[model samples]
Target chain A: MNRYPEIADRLMGLDEAVSRFVKDGCQLAIGGFTITRNPMAVAYEIVRQRVKDIHLVCHSNGQALDVLVGAGCVRRLEIAYGGNGRYAPTCVRFKKAVQRSEIEFEDYSNYQMSLRFLAGALSIPFIPTKSGLGSDLMNYEGFPPDIRREKKVASKKYAKMQNPFSEQRDEVVLLPALTPDVTILHAQFVGDDGTVRMKGLTFADIEQAKAADAVIVTCEDIVPRSFIRTDPDQNSLPPFFVDAIVKVPYGAHPTACYGFYDYDPKHLNLYRKMAEDDALFREYLDEWVYGVSSWEDYLTKVGMEMILKIKANPVIGYAPGLDRK
Target chain B: MIQYSDNEMMALAAGRFIKDGDIVFAGTGVSILAATAAKRIFAPKAVIFFETGGIDPSLDEIPMAVADLRAMAGTSLNSGLIEAFSIVGHRKLHTVAFLGAAQIDRYGNLNTTCIGDYFKPRTRFSGSGGACDVATFASGVITFMQHEKRRFVEKLDYLTSVGWYKGGNSRKELGLRRGGALAVVTNLGVLRFHEETKEMYLAEYFPGVTIGKIVESTGFPIDTSMAVEADAPTPGELQILREEVDPQRLICQAVLAAPQK
Candidate 1:
């Protein structure tokens, strides 16, 4: 029989092993709508793991994608939902890459994301879809549009007409399926058996897990199976759905954890200033993620005192985990 | 005295009602200029925010476009653009500014999201981002857009964010809390919710702007409040706008970088 704490281990990664677990061609999904995305800090583990050329799917949380994009590990992207600016704009890189024809892009909608997950869960061929079609999205598949036009003739109290600037009927929109290479998510808890826990169901994420060849998770806490069974409904990823889970606290730091606390300010200030100069942006990445030998080293560089100050401050509305305000 | 071009007149009319502190947002294109003017001339202290890009309104240049800035809240003032999202979404500031749609209806609701029905939208523009948050979070919201019949519609297919539907004080009928369109600033004139019925009413007009043109453009009846003024641009405003603010017109994103002060 396995020992009490050792039983919690599905597998263990030492300094070098941790990096190896995050192999290439793995489709990753991270939780977060806007405010509370799981920490890409665990993703830093992927980078430290030397994971390469992987597909990243960010639902709601834009920061996780930014982390991977900044890391230069993303080869192709399948983004269903990204916040306006929660993370750096990969779309720019994706756009530039597309213009150069350097990479592949597959933009998706929330509903379609859910259908894709349903496909993976059901183990189907592809999620036949409907959403985001007809609009420029259809005219320009795989490329983000200046605006998406539909097939309606009437205007509303909020929206007026399209480019015609007149009330004319457009066409129908169909949202296609989204399947990531690997799905990476952040959770409040992952039990001994590997059940993912988050704020909600996140249909898109579920689909990514089902569709992806494999799934990886970055968790805040690793507990006994008994603990997770206490609230099964809150369990997002069952052991059957998830393969690996990394335990890292304050992983979402700059990006923001959900409700427990908000994003770390100095870190955000670091990234905001990066746009002024890419060199500076890359340098910050090196210092923050790449430079550190491990998550522990990253913390040391950021300084334990600073982390305490951040923790000491009242958790802001944006994230740590809960208050959806 | 500052020269009063039709558009400048349009700006001044919108400038009214902007208090010392406001969460003024500047969208894309010329709409940004009107919003900047409002912040520079009227709401200086208002916490300036945006569609997620850099936070402060003090960018030397507007970058290539809105998307170029990403939608993060960080700004040139603090940290870089990318970093600011973490700061703002985390609740660092209290106010934010947003770019409004071309057409607004009787209610102050905006429609950046789509043109038709949700199922089969005619135009699926960038759906409401933090705009919903901005309209709801900011102390007050001021939307800017060009003035034209096409821009001012009878109704928006989607209820992106309730601007001043049923008017500000009277929106209890629709059911909302904290946010309602405060003012709609456009190239031709200004529109606000009626003090009561939540109807679109003329609060002010640009110099040389006629009541007929404004009414003709609007889908709903344009009611008149007080005898509105032209509120021409002040020499100080033009000087700052042309020189200190946007010498290269980068910040203004002006197509024709009008003569510098």
Candidate 2:
């Protein structure tokens, strides 16, 4: 019906998705950060799905977000807080993009992103709060010089500030309403009618659903209406809020789906390795997410036996979670 | 036999600077490894607040990326992933690890912000999150970065956190508290500073990495080893570093080869 195929078709076709999202100019806002992060799948799906002009906003400074930015899906980013682990560094792609002046970057604290979502959910123009007041992140798109080099330092301004009415010292950072063209969310269960349910803190998902004009929900398994009706309170997003719903198991293969499945370190390492080599990244996605006909087909090529083998081998020093593998 | 690399060795040096009963912030690389190694070696009682990963008593290899936080929480020693988040994001703990950058100055400042110019220059890197807060109030901050010339610039394009811009004692002159790079361990050597001027002097050396190489690469001047008596990693420290500190030796896995048969 549209220039691209249906939403479900777009999600499974790796290179197609990447071209659409990473290169095309589609303004998209993703959900979740590190722990409960659902965006990686959507990110990979974008690379797999090929939706374009992607814009990401979240509370984490991790690699999934970096992947989208790195793939060049991001023309501009609106984020509150973001970082990879400490030793690795932050937004390597963003830094390089900034160096090259390749993209426009609008940074806010994660709280600001959260507030934006809350404002959207609450139906407001912008939340009138100051969260990043005195911190140095206010003026510059990035940050000030390393305080280490200074013989003495000047005072700083933050990106967000806190409320005087409350006793908190942390910033209240104001977030303007973000109305993305579409929103993509990953969840545990989805019905044919587009209902989402989760076991943990859905964070600002409901707000995200309310803010966007179009929404797509991806899931590992699709439940019937009876299932969702049984535990309606547990449902994170209602059916009407979601425009499209696709069920793809192991959708969160590289990124964990939270309570549903433990993280796959092997897949993560593969992504890390892929990021180190652009050709490999494209090639791998081409062979995997896009090339395969379905989730079952992709898993078969990756080898379920290999996954089981990986499951048997505890990730060495990193402990084994609840054994979802 | 335990296998380690120069980077892991750097982690040990960074860990050594941590004292007992200190609060720490953590990220990945040597920051994560060094913090754990420090706990394994000394200051076992040192209080560490993981950045939302409940990593203080982490039992497994720390996932390097934030998404790994899910893996970490799912697997680490105690409570669920949510509990881990509480420890890092909200819980008030001490002495955590942080990643370092290319251009660290004489005063113990680090630059992970940008490359070209502040007004509008080259590249823009990931900026501060809790890094500013950790670097601001921690007992002391330890910086870890691979030592290289391309990285060590005269002035940082932008600063990620507040390091000792002046010297340790002089930080107050610029109006800062307990926030200076106390130790910076690189592949080439170990360095400490004048708590105020941030003036640096070589404290130790790595066998393969040379002083000349470091001198050529560093952005600032280093107190000559010949000019001063340098400290050495004791056998005990070395033994712990090779064995218990990183028994699995995850650091150089990024690029390691099978032992030459």
Find the candidate with the highest lDDT and give its number. Answer: 2
lDDT of 2 by residue, A210-250 (tens): 78776766676777677778878677777677666556665
- Give lDDT tens digits, candidate 1, residues A6-56: 334444433333454456755566555443444567667766566776666
TM-scores for every candidate against the unseen true structure: 0.52, 0.68
Whole-model lDDT, candidate 2?
0.54
**lDDT (tens digit, per residue) of candidate 2 on B211-253:** 7777887766667654332344566766765565445555433
Clashes of each: 77, 94
- Residue A102, model 2: lDDT of 63
Go through the candidates in order and give each one's DockQ.
0.05, 0.14
Interface root-mean-square deviation, each candidate: 13.7, 8.8
